[model samples]
Target: MSWNPAQYLRFADARLRPALDLLARIGGDTQPRRIVDLGCGTGNVTRLLLERWPAAAIVGVDSDAAMLACAGSTPSAIGWQLADIASWRAGFSPDLLFSNAALHWLPDHDRLLPELVGQLSPDGILAVQMPANFAEPAHRILRQLAGESPWRDALGAVRMGSILPPADYEQLLRPLCHRLDLWETTYWQVLSGADPIIEWMKGTTLVPFLQRLDDSAAGHFLAAYRERLAAVHPAGPDGTTLFPFKRLFFVARR
Candidate 1:
């Protein structure tokens, strides 16, 4: 199953806020002839790029058909393809490689980033944003809780990848590109209702956990998760839950 965009309302149009910030810093008059979104999940990022560069030919690629289906609904002008970046090829060298909340799934971006840059035109740009809250209490406690569950035997080996250390990312991409911008920020998301936290995660971190189990185990997982979350994520003074989320933003122009 692909990620359901409806489940990730927190990252819906709200994604544009951060996406614009990243793009603005990497601003230029070099209009791209082509653009590609590496893991175009549901095309929110893809659509944003299109809105910014309507003249550019844009393509969104993902490994999941379900995700591509949702992306296809945006417009016939945007090309959505089902393919893995590891082996995927760009029909034409893109002037900009844009990715959001994607790329941590990639194992060796340090080595891979240069290769992707090589796919760019003489002077292309690469902009990416990824959630980097693996160290946060929310993800930490959830993983620990899952490890203790009976179903851990099957899912225990799954380890989420890091979105590169801030320095490591700069070190890897700075030399290859003419300009590089890298930083991280925490968005204090005020979610209404005691249960919105679960809804927020279903579109992301909770996905793998739930996919590991059958219907029964998945229900148990969510129930246990909610119980743990309810204890840690106490309601704020406004009677809403505040999930302080963090993400890393990086842009390198070659």
Candidate 2:
């Protein structure tokens, strides 16, 4: 799916909170010599890594050229690589492998997570955070709309792949990790707009559905989705919408 950096950043502060939370939990004794930010969209979170470990050599890896282009230049010390996160390998075993809001795009964490763990140094750290808000109305509305008429035919298998429960992640990583910190947080974000929920999903969840439809059909889908969302997540007295977004976070040190 194509990503629009501008659209994704519409709620930048809200989207960035989980990344900051994930970074805060990654602790170790030795200073990292090398770090990699997998699926570093627009280098926003990657820039935080540079700030935290200015001495370390950091690389930002992403698949989209447009998003990478928006990332622009970094210091000579930081490397920007264009590659798929699923198959991308670091030239050196990194001291820290960080991915924020990226891994969920790929399915099958059962196999994928272990492959990433193997790429780490013996004592390396793997830090990740991803949206676990699939059950929320914003996403539920999309699934409901996708099941209807033209959308159903055009957007086959529109639902997200299975995202394992929180306990499942702990079970999967416990054997491989010496130290593991896993938790979930629900952020009550207050957004202001005509249809804030729809605006928010347009950046991420709505992209795939929109991609399959032409302009007219896409508009119809959005209208139907908006009506459904407004009923579920109506604006408050102050004209702000409270969007409860849940996210999963984990940090494993091998």
Candidate 3:
């Protein structure tokens, strides 16, 4: 699916907090010579990687050409590559493999996660963060709406891949790494504007479903989705909506 960099960066601060949190926990003593930011959209988090490790050679890999263009447009030493994160391989072993809010879209993490860990250089670190809020109303409603008439044929098969549970991830990665850290955090994001949740999903969760429909059908689907979301997440007297988003983070050292 095509990505809108502007839409995705609309909630930049909120989207970035987890990434910053993950970066802080990545062992301050680390002095990696090479780093890879997998699924680095628009190089937002990739920039952070550079800031933390100025001497490290950093490459940001993403499948979307548009996003890579936006990232590259910004003058920096960081190299931007257009490649699928799921099948991406480093020409040389990277000291750090960092991915923020990516990798959930790929299937078969059982094999994928271990392979990623193996790709890291000896004593390398693999730090990742992924959204684990699939059961939330935002996604549940999207799935529910897509199954109804007019949209079923177009979207019935549309699937939003999700991450494994905390226990499952521990079981999958502990054996591959000498050190592993896994945790979850629920960010009760305070958002403003009418139908903020819908706006939020438009950047990520809504992209696939919206892409499957024509403009007219997509409009209707969005309208229905907006109505349902408002009922569940009404704006408070302060005119801000609270969206509790849960995310999973892991830091593994090989």
Candidate 4:
């Protein structure tokens, strides 16, 4: 019930690809002495990062204890640290700072970002992947649908955080890290069954939404979201659903 990633593993392949792609951008023989995985959730991507940089001293940091615990149990040498990235300050010079499907949760990174970048060595690499589907129908429509639902009475001013665009990121990050590569990709996923769009959001955006609600209210929120999705996303004649999802990715070398 507390932000379980295992609940959404049905669409795991599509949801996890961006993280793998971000990790793949690291060049050969560029391994540093220490690495940090910011927003390392459930250790899925963290495991891959360790595989890529096996000998590097890896640190996995996240605010969620449950997620940190999960990461700790994963087969890796990653030192799981439960810390809120916004205020946690450390002096360790990292060789690489990697994150996937996480930075969008921290919009205050305008300040926290440069600070994290400062912890990296001059030759350190930074790779990040984020879900840019916030402004699109997937998120906007959910906000709109929530307003008309029964849970609207209990739901206060629950607004999704604003995620900056690629240009905005490039402007803030390009100067800090050299040879920056940033771009957004829309993945047209062919899923099966109805309400699969909501299923995809379950693994990502729904975390914040669910965290704020009681059990009964959360059920109502999911029910209403499914109703709206069912009406909007029609089932295909081929008996499979089509959900075009979007994600943003960035990689840079300091």
| Candidate 2 off by > 4 Å | 28-30, 73-76, 159-162
RMSD of 4: 2.2
Residue pairs in collision within model 4: none
Candidate 4 lDDT (Cα, whole model)? 0.76
Off by over 4 Å in 4: 148-150
Instruction: Compose the digit string of candidate 2's lDDT tens values, residues 88-135.
Output: 878689989999988988887999999899889998999999899988
Checking candidate 1 for backbone clashes, the offending pairs are none
Tens-place lDDT digits, model 4, residues 91-153: 688888888777777757688778888878887877888877777766877787656656565
Deviation (Å) of 206 in candidate 1: 1.3
lDDT pick, better of 2 and 3: 3
Against the true structure, candidate 1 reaches a TM-score of 0.92
lDDT of every model, 2 decimals:
0.79, 0.87, 0.92, 0.76
Model 1: residue 232 alpha-carbon error in angstroms: 2.6
Cα misplacement distance, residue 127 of candidate 2 (Å): 0.3
TM-score for each candidate, following the candidate numbering: 0.92, 0.96, 0.98, 0.90
Q: What is the clash tally of candidate 2?
A: 0
Worst 10 contiguous positions by lDDT, candidate 2:
70-79
